[model samples]
Target: MFRTLVQNVPAVADTSDTSDTSDTADVAVIGGGMSGMATALRLQSAGLSTVVLEAHGHAGGCAGYYRKRGFSFDVGATTLVDFAPGGVGAELLDSVGIAPLNAQELTGYRAHLPDREVVLHRDQSAWHAERLRMLGDSERHRRFWALLDRLAQTFWQASRAGVRLPVRGPADALHDLRAVGLSGVPLARHLNRTLGDALRSHSLRDDAALVGLLGMLVEDTVHTGVDDAPLINAALGVTIRGAGLSRHVGGMHGFWRALVTHYRGLGGRLRVGCQVSQVVGGPGHYRLTTRHSTLHARRVVCALPAARTAAICAGLPVATRLQTFLERDAQALGGACVVFLGVPEEEVAAQELTHHQLLQAYDRPLGEGNNMFVSVSASGDTLSAPPGHRAVMISTHTELSGWAGLDPAAYEQRKKEIGERLVGYARRAYPALGERAVIAQTGTPRSYQRFGFRPDGAVGGPRQRLGNTNQHAVPHDLGGPGLWLVGDSTWPGLGTVACVLGSRIVAEGMLREKGFAR
Candidate 1:
């Protein structure tokens, strides 16, 4: 059990005339995903005229949900971690004055490894006993875990205290200094290091079971394995269960509906089904052209992916770092394959845990159904399923290119094959998982590209190697004065919490750039 996410939404300050049809605002956020919406909400609350333009029919990008029959399937992300009080998501909700929707705080999930099953409990002592008893009980294991715990604590401190990246000014520098604190200052040394370095230091890098579990956590969170994931971030990722993983009552659907309502109630303009094809002009005033009209704004936050931003901002001055990131991750971007199933509750009745990560063979690489994450909606949660059924979503990391360049027949065949393969993998954990399902479908990289608007169907950020993440990750502030980027493609890359953190940084940066902050 965990603390609830029901807080009162404080009244938001009305910043602009909502009824104005001029398509002009003080700021224009290019996408309406989690990051874009959070940024625009904060800016609007701060009394800045802001508007959010989403290409999709509604918000929530990868976090978005869709319904088939009576089942609601989350498109990408399954849970919100570090979302309790004094956590990253808590700060964003508190800032926007929107109370979070009802959420079920996860106790933990069962990680079914080859050798044993480890329960990732949210409680400190339970998790300690579980990991040590399951992964390893030696001194080396203890030491590695101790280091990870310390690093995770340091990252959470910086996060909850409102850390911003790129250190835009003395103000930003001072904020980071205070947020990181003297006790945590030394931990910054871990930034350039990789999780492999930490594990090797403890002489536990060769522990296949331990490393495989880390790969499961980090690959899902930071989008990398133990060897390449940045030390500090991987630490946070591995410990997210401790920070708290909360699944909304209706999953992302309830969360987004409430958030969009809060934003609109605050008089912030949100234009759905509006795709901005070109962003021309900058250094103050800018013009965003969509099929409907050309919106004018003094500031523009290109919350789209790095590659898409590069494409649309042809006339505007794009940043060198952004282009560098686009090229660097063009072929390397990771996508996901998801299998959505709606089955009777009895199918999952044998499962004690609602969420599970199954790795059939630890020796096998993590992807293409080898490492599968299975999530079942809460029993009797009618918002996500029918009265006697539960919504099940199983997903795994995938190579985007594998799903590309195939003819129609080949593509359909490949999709069908992958879907069946994942369902087969899930059977090891939930024997009746997708049996007798009323609704079943598969989503591939091409599906993501079509529906999510991600370039080449890239899902999460880069593999989060030491070279491409942290300071080297794409900055929120592009070179142009009014230009900015926020999303999985940017710093603190990928995840619901990361997007909120990125939004906070961009909102603060924009306020300061517009002379609203000290």
Candidate 2:
């Protein structure tokens, strides 16, 4: 069960005067997701006047929550890692004055295969040892762990350095040099020559168990195959071991609310239900024409997808290289998710199931409910469910184009069918799950598009390809002066850590441009 630490801090009454806009701020942040919120809060604390415009009524984007009949459900992410002490995510939260909660540490992740159940322990050494033991005395696990450990340490150093500096020209080159220096080799070469060759040569071809385990890891970490993903990015997951992945007390939305509270406290202004229509560069300033009114700022940070940026800045010098990168990166192949609520605690309690379970049906491929990751949040937690009822969230990846041409009626039907299939898979693990589900809802690529404001309902913006991957070519630079971009489309792809890290990079860039000390 998830728990919260109650701090008796008095609420700050809403002091925003929407009608008053005489002064232009240092920055105008478009989008109020975690990345946007992080940027606005940090810039405002640094004594820069900042305004955040959110198209949605709420702050969180995909990380938002929904409620139906006393049940609360997280729309996007359910589980998060690297939020422990000394971690970048934790440091970001603390820097904004949001107190961290004492979260319950999950013991292991259940991996269901055709013939056996694999419980991936939280401890790295123990998890590697168990895998070696399970594989019947194979030494491959030992070698894999050693390589993963080196990669993780190097990636951590890169993440730390990247979060602090601006990604431009020679500075970006130096950053890459520092990352390689720390890692002792180029990230791409290391992945292709080491991790890639090792897995292909030995395990993936022979061991079904190893393939299943690696499949789950790759799917969870990069939302893609091992060969297509960067080793540094993949290593982030390995290093996260023993860091105790935790869920927000109420739901992911509660975390968003907490962040908004912190943002407001830092004197950051947020305007909701406001959509940016155009971003025109004025002399030494940026004019953001919104659906309602126009605002001006010395800098404008667009925390949106590449397509959205293209839509707003229609007349800018349009970075052709960046545009090409966005086009190539637009492949959203991650699958859809089906969330169920109002599950009875007693049904799953007897099975010793807490809030999480992984379901695998031997009849399907790895991406098609062959393995389903399940999470449960207790009822009346004000975060996940109503009193006495539980919330279940399940996710799997699919090609973005799969749901492209369906009409509304067809879409709804598809969702129902998929939801039923997932519910059936869940039943194999917990027999009584179907009877306990009071509410069944499905989020397709179309739903993600409607809710997340993504062009193609790409859950994680722009897939990070292995080679020709320009880490600096990310659309963080807005193609002109006084404009920037943040969010998942930036350097690091997805996850809470990536969003926060992208925000820090944007803030640092803006600060340097404005002559602020590091």
Candidate 3:
């Protein structure tokens, strides 16, 4: 159900303004996140006139940033993965002659467990040694790693080839077949299986600690626990270090600014502080209703949450099946919370902490007071913090139901409690946290709603659980010709890498519709 926040939605009034012709475009992207920017740039590269509409003052969406006092903190995402040569971000940036930010290589995140502290390094050899030293080496562990390695490699290759999900046309279906080739046969074998099933197959299901760790790691990325995590994506989550992960020199916002700069340089028009209220259209064209103007476009790309997308599509000439699917996908998703902190440089230097860390508690649940993913900036990274200060971003998965149905006072109390609990966990993991803590703030799903423009301030896309993987994922096309989705809400799921990949798929779809591709 849509939140009752808006008591009455304004009806779309028919406008016959002749001056509105200036707002028309070959394609209109309905969100200015990384995905929307990528789609607009790619379309322009293909010789199509494109316009981008962003609700926020800037781009980046969930991967955006906020500045307070003299400190800069990430609004949502802290780290970026997939910086390799042929990666999605790499290719996209290269297309516009934009160089990526100077990123520090992340060996692996430090996981603070109940019995031991372990580091999962990017190098396979170092990771193996650390794993054996921490958790007694077992045949089950070896088998699971091997399987994930194979699946992850294949998944990367397929993603690089721009494999579209929930295929809508013959071109996409054929592309999927060609991209997978013979190697992806193994992935097909486990199409219906979950990570829990794989653990059982390897006789590792009895290892409670290992299962708990896997659940902790996956719940952040896949939006589901180990028992329900889809095997294909779970495999990628497990082997995340195999590819590469990095932190931008300034922050996430800097990276987004680079993309936006390159996009505008390529002649793409961006309209910030412009929110599309409804989209009503047919096959070849779309009429988008914004707060102050009614824009017309030959193609519409919605880079937003499923519920929000469904709300707009409800006013369109879309099929019943697609609208129903979007509504259901929205309800199936969870939420996320992030805590930002500013600490003095002296305390951070004394501890010599890594850029990223994952702290997990053995006795409690993952989000409440048990698990957190933390990212700290280098002491002298002036863009994030001054020379004498440091910036820290902490996040955890949360359910929307926990935040709903509360009075204003109760909601504020619950938010404070969660923020304090997360701070406590961070302090425990990094003892120097309290000593240098200068300023602190918390962002909830509602914060995300305000800044990221997602529904209920939800984080991530829908949960990619058992029945929500591969072809079962939400379709990029909501069963409407020339309409598409290109973000975490669609197939390929969440993360910066997935968003870029999904963007390319949507770009390809648009190009095909324009007869630019087969």
Task: Choose the strongest candidate by lDDT.
Answer: 1
CA shift of 325, model 3, Å: 1.8
Candidate 1: stretches off by over 4 Å: 1-22, 168-170, 319-321, 514-518
Q: Is candidate 2 or 3 superior in lDDT?
A: 3
lDDT of 3: 0.74
- Per-candidate TM equals 0.94, 0.88, 0.91
- In each prediction, how many residue pairs overlap at the backbone (N, C-alpha, C within less than 3 A)? 0, 5, 0
| Candidate rank order under lDDT | 1, 3, 2
Per-residue C-alpha lDDT of model 2 across residues 1-518, encoded as one tens digit per residue: 10110111113213222554444777899887778888898888788888998776567776666556666677777755667777667867776677885354566666666677666777777876777777445566666666766777766766655633334578766766776574465544664442355566556434666656665666666666555655656667544544557777767756766777777877788877678889887435778886557888877888887678778877775534357766566554364565555676665665444444453643346565655677777434654666666787877766766687988788778777777777777765667885846776777777767666767777766555564233444656656556777887666767777788888777777777744333
lDDT of each: 0.82, 0.66, 0.74
For model 1, residues 342-396, the per-residue Cα lDDT tens digits are 8998999897779999888878889998788999999878988989999999999
TM-score leader: 1
Worst 10 residues of 1 by lDDT: 1-10
Task: Report the backbone clash tally of model 2.
Answer: 5
Give lDDT for model 2: 0.66
